[model samples]
Target chain A: MTGRLGFWLAHLFVLAYCGVLLAGFVVQFGADELPCPLCILQRQAMILVMCGPLYIIGRARRGDVTLADYTMGYGMSIVAAVVGAGVAARQILLHIVPPDPGYGSAVLGLHLYTWSFITFCVVLVFCGVSLIFGRELVPRGVRFGWASKVVCGLFLVIVAANLVAVFFELGFHWFLPPDPTRYETFHGLPLLGAAAMSGGAVG
Target chain B: MAILIFAVLLLAGWLTVRGSRRATVLVVWTVALCAVLAVFNHHMAAKLSLNF
Candidate 1:
């Protein structure tokens, strides 16, 4: 594994992980499942994890490839992943006991929070391996490729989506609900079909 | 709180673009760690707080 390949792989993995989170959001909206406060926090963790790759790409574009640079990115990613895992674990513990009824609708036989926990764990392993094999990921002054540009674009879109989602879920400045079940846009409107679905199964 | 979280993220993103590498990493790590602590205890905090 050459340094260039390692760099590209790490960036690609970050993009792929971003895609996974986006897909999860699609499911959440499609299934009319409202995200709980913890779920929203987990999404923020996802954004934080995504930032590592964006930082790497930014540095690579500026021709600032160094061992230290790679280490910083890896460290940021690993820390965010660990934190994300903790958030997921908290959500899992909240619902695991009796009378809680667990999380919302399951995906592929696992709850969304459960999937988040698993993904965060995978991120931990991935970042750990990337750091352990850090020698390979150092930039070699190679020009940023088309794939990197695409991934950067994807990251931007995901960030925008996150911002918009939060704005609609919680109000503009404050007013964040402990457990959000409705979009802020529909706050005062009568219960409609889509609004009904946003209630989610979990109380 | 959600807006504040986003604000912190945007600040981190900006710092990542313009600030020193160590500074950016520190910001990212701090935010993520703080989020974990907050999320883990959000329910309990809400239950106990007079203002949430």
Candidate 2:
């Protein structure tokens, strides 16, 4: 495939993956399943992975995909995926030996954390192998297209929402609960939306 | 920590779209953010004592 095609494919894949992740978040929040600190960490890893493609989309705005661009993007993604896999694996080990009940609902017999581990490992291998053939996907000077704009815009919105979620849960004071069952707010008020109303409020 | 990372991400996004001749800057900023998140993940896992 041409570098252009590869760029489009890679960007689309990242956006689709993030869309699914956003859906997962909706499911979790809709179910009132508050994310733990570890879960938050995993989400951050996902964001990092997303940024690899995001950077490309952004860079592609000015030019075509280059070998250096692919290398850096894939490298960043692979490293992040590896770290994410490690985190997920840690979560898995925590529940496996002790056979703890586990967090969130099970999906197809495996918990979400287990699925995250598998997903991260798969992403890691994919990025690593893709990097080996980076030369094949050469950067050609290209302009920002509508599709690229949409993908970047979507990613931005998701990241912003993630920020809001984290803020609502932990607040500016960094008061993270060991086990969060629900979002902490003043009288169920939205802390993220109205900041001045609750000045000096922490958690 | 989450707040800080997102702030950086928002800045990177801005740079990616707005900064003149900032392709290199954007790439470096993103890679740096990824590294920081990875290290933070390790720290959080260790702090929580997730084991392995």
Candidate 3:
């Protein structure tokens, strides 16, 4: 696989990540299900995993793509996916009992975290395959065309949205509840006040 | 705060797409470190019923 091929592949990877993030959002607002702290961590890992491809694309635009760049990109992605998979797995195990109904609603018969685990596994395979085949020298001066910009822009918007969502979910609190029921910032409830009122420890 | 962390990650990503090779490398590593730390912190703070 030539460097140019790898660069385009990176673009596709970015778009795929964007789609996944968007789907998560759809579930959040569309289903009125608030993500728990673990779910948020999984999302964070997804963002971190996507960063690998963004790094590769950025370097390619500078006309300085290298084998090490591909390696590093794939390596970072693998590490992030591993962490994400672990989190998703933990969540799955938490509600694995036969009588337990699982957290939140299931999408296509599998919970969001289950989908996340599957996505991470796919990412691991994708990165590993790309690494094996992507050994050719990358040509310099690869264009950072409009399509790439649009994809990156979409990714930026998604990240920004996540930032806003997290702030609202956490409010002035340093930590979110293990299971968040409402947007603390939106309700204008201070973390201490909410905790005191509920007679529950601040999460 | 998670918001602050995401903001930093967003900034890094923005700087990355602006065509800075140095920023791309830095952001990748920074994000990786942050993801690990965030997960570790969540495990420490949130009560879970896992035994392993």
Candidate 4:
């Protein structure tokens, strides 16, 4: 892919991911208790993910990626990937061992702890794959190290397999339960006449 | 499963970023879900209090 296309995809993913994360956080804080430690770490990975696109765009906006800026940006992503992977591993252990009861009914809604784990893994993959772009390939003497090709490749393989497993599950009709709704707020009473609600839905 | 929600893109922002014309449709959907939950939240809390 062209650099610009890659840039746009990176931007789009990170931006939307951040949006959903913030919305979920709002939903959580509005109702329940404080976020767990793993949740906070997941948010850190999110910040790291968002930072990559921001740094690139900000530098482009300013007309160039200064050597220092490029190095720092690359460094941040590398650190984030490692940290994110660690967080993911921690959450996965919790998932397997059951350290904390999921904060909410797993059948009724998404569990925040589970989400923290998944988001951590997503960020780890995003950051790790992003480093493969080699945007900050250092000069001979400056070369610190290359990202682990083997580990990154294995991660991609596992994620791809998991996605296929999801497709299989979908084929089998396994699905989360949703609550039945009683009030049809939009189509209900005289106060909710279609005329008044037409604009409401349109909005 | 929640996996379906991921595959289907729970938030429309993903669809919009993927080039959907009316991605903001998701914002309204989310707001509606939140409003319903909020209303239920109050009702459920009240009902539980009376039972107690």
Which is the winner by DockQ between candidate 1 and candidate 3?
3
User: DockQ of every model listed?
Assistant: 0.33, 0.38, 0.57, 0.06
Q: In candidate 3, what are the lDDT values of residues A1-203, reduced to their tens digit?
A: 36567778888999998999899889899998998888888888888888888877777576777777777778888988988898888888888989899999998999899999999999999998987776763324477778889888998999999999989889999888877999889688577577677786543
In order, candidate lDDTs are 0.72, 0.69, 0.80, 0.42
- Candidate 4 lDDT over A7-86, as tens digits, reads 45545555555564555446444654333334434443544444444344334433433444444444544555455555
Model 2 interface CAPRI class: acceptable
List runs of model 2 lying over 4 Å from the truth. Answer: A187-203, B17-52
Q: After superposition, how far is residue A39 of candidate 4 from its true place, in Å?
A: 2.0
TM-score of chain B of 1: 0.53
What clash pairs does model 4 have?
A: A175-B1, A176-B1
Q: Mind giving the per-residue lDDT tens digits that candidate 3 earns over B11-39?
A: 76787677666645575557655655765
TM-score of model number 2: 0.80
| Chain A TM-score of candidate 4 vs. true chain A | 0.50
- Model 4, B1-52: lDDT tens digits are 3233233222322222222222243343234333323433343354333332
The DockQ of predicted model 2 stands at: 0.38
Candidate 2 local lDDT, B1-52, one digit each (tens): 6667666766665555442344655565556456555655555655664343
Best by lDDT: 3
Candidate no. 1 TM-score: 0.82
Q: Order of all candidates by TM-score, from best down to worst?
A: 3, 1, 2, 4
